[model samples]
Target: MERELKLTVATERWNSAEEWKELKGYAKTFMLLMLLSMTFVILIGIGSYMRHEISAKQTTYGLATVDIKQSALQGMLAEELPYYASNQKLDTFSLSSLGLWLLEKVTNVSLLDPASLVASEMLYSSVEEQSTLIHGGEGSDPAIAPQDDKNMSLAPIDDEYLDELLAEVGNDNSSEPDEVPVAPEQEEEPAQPQGVESAAKPVAFIYHTHNRESWNSETSNDDAQSTKNNITLVGQRLAEELEKHGLGAMVSDTDYPTAVPDYEWEYSYKYSRKTVKEAIASNDELQYVFDLHRDSQARKYTTAEINGESYAQVYFIIGQRNPNWKENEAFALKIHEKLEEQYPGLSRGIWGKNANSGNAEYNQTLSSQSVLIEVGGIDNTLEESYRTAKALADVIAQIHQSEG
Candidate 1:
């Protein structure tokens, strides 16, 4: 077993001296590439194993480390993104950087687009309208006449919407809560003898249902005002004009709306009704009660150019639900007819709305001579509304002069 034959055949076929010199360079380069490839594979495997281990540990122990790390990463991105965007040139490919760049572009585009501004305005107006519809605090009178989507003409009012506004009425109609009666329906009254007038006595009582309705003429051509400085001032001017025409007028500046615990529109008329009753009962000379209001329509709908002067268009609203609506209707027709004859385009035609359609009686049941007058629109300026009021005073005075 220890005997071994010694062989002496030496062979250099595998690596001859000349071949080794030439092959060494290629062999060295191949070995280096292989080493690098193996090292990369090994590192990838290690990383995968580490992730698995971390996931397993989290599953077993319910550790918050991953969540905390995610939060930290998001916070870091949020905090660093602006700095990187402002300071550094964002030429590198990164997901967070791309997102930030896109957001900035979108912001810039929104600022440049005029439609975006219009969209924002529409949104704001819609929000305001819905809020008023819900709260019953329509200081701008938007619900009084909504925009007509179809024809863009003067839109008829929604009565059901107006009916909901009655929530503002107080418990003054009856001592018992249930005793308040709906305005009773009666036969239309015959026209009374015309030309009934008393000398040197106030015959007209003018008041505002929405005294807070204002105009934004100082700021913009559009109507966006809602301060106390609007419609109430027009009423004052109208009262003055009435006196000049020999028609004594009592104008009320009562902010009865402030007494409302909430935006109670129903109570608005009821509260004003109390004021009306007190006026009529206290003064036997008061013959006509006018509930002056501002129309919420657009400028074109409420404005009229008459004899090179601008005036707000006027409308006479008749409540057919009241028992004495015929009397009110007759008087309103007379006024409307008279105005049409003199002022022409200043009149916007008469509108009749019943309880089935809007506020029903609209406190018209309280008196036979009650009339609801809408003067101008939201876009109408104080000067325009005042001019119409002056013209109105003239018309009423002429009617009064014709009285017996």
Candidate 2:
């Protein structure tokens, strides 16, 4: 039979084709898997790059110069950009900064920063803060002055008015849900007790230069200014919280505009300076002095969420005009670092300003331990601000304990 059989070359190869078919299938599968893997890696890279770009744009650091012409560049550089380089440095120039500058000019919407845009002339103004922000929450301009200065009235806050406000703060507002508002999805949790009680003389003094600064939520007004509800209430809350931490804190509720004769908003520092001097003179034991203020920015720039609770964000301002501002900055840095550890994003960051822009000294020359604190903004709620006050007291107590 073998001798009689005749097979063509094609038939002979077909008899052993199983092996070749299997190899071809394997090769195709391997190539497909390789392509899929490469595709996955490319997608991941694109996503990562996009995330990093957005973060870089929003980041306060880096070599980004501000767009300062009628925009809030000066305010932002003064408020957020601590590591910003000199304007003369060509190497540090940022195209992003330039783009932001151009965008701000063309749109007038403050695409770059959300600071005090409405009141550039005043540095920080009550009326300017009430204006609607470009993005509903972001504007970096320092603040714009009202068109008619003659018609502007000083916030009608006096010592008598402050006393009335203080009297109400002690009363338990049972109708209010809580001192700290929670996120909608979060359930109300019992607040942890703050600090050990102690009978100690006051070492900290909390005062407000812009005592009439009020929150939109508290005042229910556009101006966010009132003789009834003001930043002095927040200072009072801080003093109470500090007391709970076993740190004696004295609060000043002096309405500067009313306290000083022929009061001018520009002379607010001068008025507050007298207050600080008198307090220091009265008590040499005072080591820490905090000038509490409300920022002119919108809610988004001044709010933070910790766990399920909402809190007003804080910023520490150092006056470069003071020869010893570095020492004060160091002290502020300690508190800031502690906050970053315990509660992240609670502090926006430390900012420095000299005489060229705003209140250059901010009374930092009075004491190396002195620092200006801007809590919340015109749009924050009293509950949010109180939460921040408690948070600040918690950290300050820790520092005090550590130092002691």
Candidate 3:
């Protein structure tokens, strides 16, 4: 009986040991599954965070790229922005205004529509009129004779008229003595007077003359003087090139107010027109008038390069709001063509008549040959732009020669 009891206890102990082993194996399997689930959750969180970071970075990079590209393009083409921080005009006339206008007009995105913005501004400001004059005035022909013959016969003769007539006849006779009936003098036609080639009149420059003190005031004199010095240097170079090509050219400042920093955007048109009209009145020989200026985009200073040397790009701006826009565009095209030929890729491209919200007329209405040339942005050193100016003078000389 004792041996049987001992054997029974041993068998019970063996069964308990087998049950404990099975529980331990189940616990190990559960722990392994839990670790795998936690690892998967951790990996998912890390992946999601990386994806968000990448997306945010891409958005930031894209915006910066767009702004830089636009600015570089503007500099190359010579479009005007607002003046310095003191005189801000860009807010009133935004590029977005022009962009929205283009979005409304252009059906396809593929077309090169630089004037989309300008067209919108036109739609709002354009007015249709039957007369050519800006102000209403009676149109008449002074050259036409009156229908009444009686009125013509009733006119009285005056001593002043008779004296003028006799004087003119006497002068004519003296000048044509060889034609008188004295054997015709065998005058040899005076050798037909060899045709004389007149030297080309030098190209003239016009700038705002008023507010000279403000432009070169106590606070901003250095900045203003620097800009003027650069301009004078460029003018000198242009004059030299013109002389080299036998095109007589001169650069002078119009006695008008200099464009105030903040006033350039809104009041530029008025000031520009006043100056140009004055120029026309003073010198009818003024053929090409260039309003020189600098830009404000920061990136333009970095992107422009010429002959492996980084420099500021130049732009040609035109206004589509004026009646003389077609001629202005033609003049711009000529400048672009000439510049590109002389300095390949130096010019960005000719901007359309309407692009930005700033003044469209830009004093171009004063003359068909007038243009606004933006040398570089504020960030660019004055020296870099002067180099560009030298190249530009060469190009202008070539164009002048060709025209002659």
Candidate 4:
């Protein structure tokens, strides 16, 4: 009986020990899980604090003090975020742009649209002070205080002088001391004069999808948009100038904002596609299509000095969404090469755009010869743009004539 009692006691002891072991294991697991949860919460708090601090400082100091000197980063940002790239030299830095850039960097996602962001309005109240300079208002004082954009518009030039300037530009040998720098051969034989009649049916079409896009000097209100003095005028000028080169050209006047029943700016290319189709159907002779736009960059990047005159530079945009985009790029390269030879520093290299960046196709599939050209920036004046139009006409004419 004593032996039986001892065995029962031993069994009870073993059972107690086993229960203790299981309890210890549970404690260890709970401790590990609690530790992990605490670490995660701490990390999240730190990240939120850092983001808040950085944003606060950026708001107060305008990121200008950051002095981002990395060219590769700048180029990449410019390529990806068009607004941040374009407003590099603004008097007041844009807050939304800075936030978007940081967000994109941290998230590793592309942010291409800038129109949706609330941006600081850049003002050019001291344009008169800038006009006195030689480089078409580039290098203007950044110290000018930002003001409300009310009644800001391009100062009118003397009409007689403008006519004389156009005439000199058209003349083969007319003595203008600062004539457009041309290739050695072109200097001997100037471009065909500006009013030559072309009997062939209109083979080139020039149109503006963003017809209301206006320069700082072109608008008279808070927004840089206008009904009359806008990009359409540039398209019109290009068409008339192309006609002077014996290439019949037509310009579109379809104002999408009013013409479309429910117009959305994002669907601008859709409206323009309809216009291009109609033009093609009506005129089978159309061989080339040109879409003209003004860049949103600063004056320093968009203005070029040639022969003591400031000419608004050109940027060729080829739509990568088109299956035959390479063909259009090749055609653009031909024009770009001619511009480089004739008007050095006028072409700002060719860039390709896709849906992530913009309307990917840009209606380029319509024709291999189709191209989109950015003539200048917001700060460029009408006269500077006109000179660029004339130069483009000269180069395009030479190319067309050679092909024939």
lDDT of each: 0.60, 0.64, 0.47, 0.65
Model 4 per-residue lDDT tens digits across residues 197-312:
24568888788887777788877765677888887787778877888877898788667898889886656776786677566655657788888887777787778999999998
In order of listing, the candidates' clash counts read 12, 16, 19, 1
lDDT of 1 by residue, 1-404 (tens): 22332222123443476688778988999999999999999977975665454332122222233223344355456566886456644334456744544433322113434454343233123211111111111122222332211221233444554454344333234322212233233123322111122245777877776666666563443444455676767777877888888777777777765655574644466567656655565455777788888777788777788899999888777775554456677788777777777887887766655443345466676566788888887778888988999898888888888884
Q: Worst lDDT window (10 residues) for model 1?
A: 129-138
RMSD of each: 22.5, 18.7, 23.3, 21.7
List the candidate 3 regions with Cα displacement exceeding 4 Å.
Answer: 1-200, 208-237, 254-265, 299-303, 353-356
TM-score of each prediction:
0.51, 0.54, 0.45, 0.53
Instruction: Name the regions of candidate 2 deviating beyond 4 angstroms.
Output: 1-199
Candidate 4 at residue 313, lDDT?
A: 83
Candidate ranking under TM-score, highest first, comes to 2, 4, 1, 3
**Higher-ranked by TM-score: 3 or 4:** 4
Top TM-score prediction, candidate number: 2
